[model samples]
Target: MSDIQSYKQTPKYETFSYLPEMNADQVRRQIAYCIAQGWNPAVEHSEKENAFGHYWYMWKLPLFGEQSVDAVLAEIEACHREYPNQMVRFVAYDNYAQSQGMAFVVYRGR
Candidate 1:
């Protein structure tokens, strides 16, 4: 039988959770996708231990209509710089659906 008790698994967040950590280029691609879909992008961060919690600190207001990919990337970079010790996440808010459309960790902090 497998020793379930001895096996330790890392926590997985939203999109790309099963894949390797995404690079800046990959992140940019995701942001571009969000913008292409006409969804708003938002930045958020949380302490590593609290990453699974229901709430995280929003980096700023969500970027409304027709945001540039570079602008979204800049906000992500700023949040990472300010919260180097915390986990940073990028998300897309769907205005039509009036809810979060997608989310994934952009940076992981130890």
Candidate 2:
């Protein structure tokens, strides 16, 4: 067996894990897409060590029927400020699909 092939890689967290960390504009665009789809926006946070865990603490209730991307971005910033040492994620819930349509880490823990 090849050692390189046998090496266990570290597990990555949610969406966009394989890609470079998103910049502010990219995050805003994603939130805008969610809003455009009429999905609800929600924020969640967790300790960096537990980011891969099944659950995270929701920042607040999901923002339903919110149209402005700025509002969602503001909420993300607020969560980041409140939990600077923890990972913060932005999630979009699709009511029609009955599940999360999109989710990604907005802020990595220090």
Candidate 3:
């Protein structure tokens, strides 16, 4: 799906929701960049229409440590398939420091 043109108009009670940081074409490269930097990728989703409704619901998932890019790609693909209607995200974690590096709100519904 394309980015939400307007967040408040699209879903939630929030007055504003940030725009997507990564466009479609940039996804793979950005994921690869995060992996190259040794960050682990994980997925999460919010079921509400205004995703922030009831507070940005998220999945409690394990980190993908030292996983191959293919594995990460496969997991991301799975996330898209699993949560086709909800808002999903791909977040990279720096396990060494145990903190988030970066994240991309998924745009590909395929």
Candidate 4:
């Protein structure tokens, strides 16, 4: 977890707000499900201003070799705790291609 805390009550950065359908529980389970099949995982998010665009896709980090869904979920939860009102996401990457993977927001707001 980060020692620094953000009490801004909202994402000071850009983020997507239309993907609550992909909540934390779902994302965590989905990643676990995929990794059980031998896929990898990573995470990322956007600033507040970029949130709420239904058709927009947020930026993300590269697919790391880290396949621990628990750790990723922990990171996601920590991110939400640090930025309670911000947006956060998780990604599942398989051995398909470098730029091919699944991405979705896992946290909407506090």
Candidate 5:
């Protein structure tokens, strides 16, 4: 039997925001581009409202060993350039030790 308690899984990368103008096709295309660039999509969530009349899409990606923030940022920037209609933002989380292993959060706005 597998020891569930002995398995320690790392947290997945995540990004969130309220993007009302982004349509399903646009979001999916951007995600596809990111995946083509070697980024794996972990999860996505969205909601629609008559009041705001906008749709939101949250996405997550998996991170491997140590990665350079600049490299990640550059990749995101390239994505933005490739898709001018999409507004993308990135944030890095500091690990508990604050020594290394930072996390990245990417937000794509319409």
Candidate 6:
């Protein structure tokens, strides 16, 4: 198996929930807003009814040298405040599972 497959058992992600009816325009705007705040956009994927049954967006922010989880969560909270309609969730996993990472915001379609 591939290295990634070998690590498949590892729990490397966390999820956040958002309105499931957001349109593409709104999703794009939210992503742009997050980027403006200095957070890096790592992955973007779409899901159909057969998949997640809704559409969503996921982002990642780098935790530079010794940054605390609370600090990162605060940044994510700030983004949510900036976008009232958007819901953001931040999760920090143990190093054994994954390094410092976040789910950021997930815009679900209504």
TM-scores for all candidates: the values are: 0.88, 0.89, 0.63, 0.58, 0.29, 0.31
Q: Which pairs of residues have clashing backbones in candidate 3?
A: 11-50, 12-50
Writing each residue's lDDT as its tens digit, candidate 4 over 32-101 gives 8867766667656655566655433333454467667787777767666767776676666667675435
**RMSD over all Cα atoms, model 5:** 16.2
lDDT tens readout by residue for model 3, 1-110: 57656556643332223544556557778778888988977777666455544454445564556457666666666766777877677778888888878766663332
- Give the number of the best model, judged by TM-score: 2
Q: List the residue pairs that clash in candidate 6.
A: 19-108, 20-108, 20-109, 20-110, 21-109, 21-110, 22-109
Residue runs of model 3 more than 4 Å from their true location after superposition: 1-24, 53-60, 108-110
**Among all candidates shown, the one with the greatest lDDT:** 2
Give me the overall lDDT of model 4: 0.59
Ranking of all predicted structures according to TM-score, beginning with the best and ending with the worst: 2, 1, 3, 4, 6, 5
Q: Single out the weakest 10-residue window by summed lDDT for candidate 5.
A: 43-52
User: How high is the lDDT of residue 99 in model 2?
Assistant: 99
RMSD of 6: 13.7
TM-score of 1: 0.88
lDDT of 5 by residue, 46-96 (tens): 221221223323334533332344444455656556544543433332344
- lDDT-better candidate, 1 vs 5: 1
User: 4 or 6: which has the higher TM-score?
Assistant: 4
- What order do you get sorting by lDDT, best first? 2, 1, 3, 4, 6, 5
lDDT (CA) for every model shown?
0.85, 0.87, 0.64, 0.59, 0.37, 0.40
lDDT by residue (tens digit), candidate 6, 1-110: 13232224532223323223335455455545544444443433233232233444443444433234344445554555554454444433334445434443343222
Angstrom error at residue 26, model 2: 0.8
Preferred candidate (TM-score higher): 2 or 5: 2
Runs in model 2 with CA error above 4 Å?
Answer: 1-11
